[model samples]
Target: MLKQFGCTKFATGEDFDTGELFVQFEHRGRMVSLIASSKGYAAAWLKENPYNNRRKGTKADHEAKALEKGGTAVYSILRDWVKGQVTAIEIGMLSFESAFLSHILLPSGKRVIEHVEEQKLLEGK
Candidate 1:
């Protein structure tokens, strides 16, 4: 079945006044060229740090814990749930705002916005 996961928008140019916008999700992604409307303004935000690099053994510990979860683990369990289905997802303006709030511009000029929203699974066809 088709599912409405979540949404995210990626700024595609240095000029914030006008640029390309990318709407992304688990099943598909879209690029909305030419951002002209003020109502849909995009603001860059910071990336979420899932792990602490300064802390030793943190990465390893997290990986080890994830492995313990096994095939039926949290990640796998979620993956298995959406194994075979025509997922149709639609992201609204709210998600776009959230994504913009979590974006950060890189030194190389590319903007990175990670993990916009918590994944939501839908059942059926």
Candidate 2:
């Protein structure tokens, strides 16, 4: 879907130590990156699935499995989300910038959302 809409390249990276994953793509001459944390998702999943007593695994092994599951879940979620946003852009429901503003890279070598975070732009008044 992304290639159909002016995305020329796509790549992915992962950090097992940090449980972070990122995907980078070129869209309409601009580089956009999206990031997710397997640890964060795993934490959330653990909250919902607190009881793993029936599972036979050491603590570290359980954590490792959880992180792996989280990574898979996050990937699926990101795929669906990107497809939806691309569809929205394709159908004229949104502009590319509006659809992916947060993921869009800026000249400052940071994502737009990073700048927004530095400035606390989303903070409540």
TM for every model, in the order presented, reads 0.18, 0.90
**lDDT of all predictions:** 0.32, 0.87
Backbone clash tally (model 2): 0
Off by over 4 Å in 1: 1-28, 31-68, 76-93, 97-125
Model 2 TM-score, all chains together:
0.90
Query: TM-score winner among the candidates?
Result: 2
The regions of model 2 sitting more than 4 angstroms off are 51-53
lDDT of 1 at 124: 39
**What does the lDDT come to for candidate 2?**
0.87
lDDT (tens digit, per residue) of candidate 1 on 1-125: 22444325423222323332232233235322222221122111111223467745677674443333332233333333333221311233244333333333334433343222322223237
